[model samples]
Target: MQLDHVTLVTHDLEGTCRFFRDIVGLDDGPRPLFRVDGHWLYANGRPVIHLVDATGPARLSGGSSALVAPRIDHVAFRVAPGVEWRALVERLAAHRVPYQLTEVPASAEVQLFVALAPGVVVEFVTSLPVGAAA
Candidate 1:
C-alpha cells in the first residue's frame, strides 16, 4: 500500500496553486470548477494534491511553522537524486517564501522547502532509492 494524495483545506485555491507552481515548481493544471470549491493538481500524472476551498475565514495561528501538528503537517515530493536543490531554494527565496532544510532520520537525504501558506508547509524530498516512483 502506498500513499496516493493529500486534500488540503484552503480559502484561496488560486493562491495555493501559485504557491505550488511558482515556489515549489509544480505544474499548475487548469482550474477545476466544482460545485463546492476546489482544484486538483497532478504531479507526474497522479493527482497528488487537492485544494478544497473552506467555507469559512482563515484561522490565523501563532505557530512559527506549520509542521507542528500531525494532521498532514506537510506534503512531500520526490525529485531526482543529485539534483540542484539549492536552485530550488533560490527560486523560493526569490519569491520571498520562508522555508527550512532538514535531513530525514536514518538517511543521508536532504529535504528542501518553504511554507505553502501561513499554516501549510511543503516538503521536497529526494531520497527515493533508484527506480522508485509514486
Candidate 2:
C-alpha cells in the first residue's frame, strides 16, 4: 500500500495553513465534519497533510500549548518533475524560513528540506510522480 496522509498538531491553525498553502503550494481540501478546527492540504488532488488545532472545537487528543511535533524526524512528499521551485524558494526567503536543497545519493533526484517552525520539518523529494513512487 501507498502512503495516505500525515497528521500534525498545531497551536496556530492559520499559521500552519499559510505555511503549507502559501509556502509549500498545497491547496486546501475539504475535511470531514469532525468537531475540530483543522484543515486538509492537498497535493496531486489528494489530501496529504491533516492539520489539527491543539485548541480547537474539541480536545480530540492532547490539548496542551506545547508544540506537538511529529515523532519521526521528518515527513517527506515526493514532488513531480518540472515543479517550479524558484517561486517556492523565494517564498521561503520572504518568510525568512531557512532551507537547503540536498541531492539524493546515487541518484539525480534532489530533496528540499525546510522547517515551517521549530520541530516541524517537512521534506520535498523531487523528481518523482505520485504513481511512480516506490
lDDT of 1 by residue, 59-78 (tens): 43784454433356777777
**Residue 111, model 1, lDDT:** 76
TM-score of 2: 0.72
Counting clashing residue pairs in each candidate, in order, gives: 0, 0
RMSD of 2: 6.2
Q: What are the Cα lDDT values of the candidates?
A: 0.70, 0.78
- Winner by lDDT: 2
Clashing pairs in 2: none
Q: Give the TM-score of candidate 1.
A: 0.69
lDDT of 2 by residue, 1-134 (tens): 99999888778889999999988899998999888789999998999899988763332356665544336568887665664655666788898988877777667677889876666789977664433422
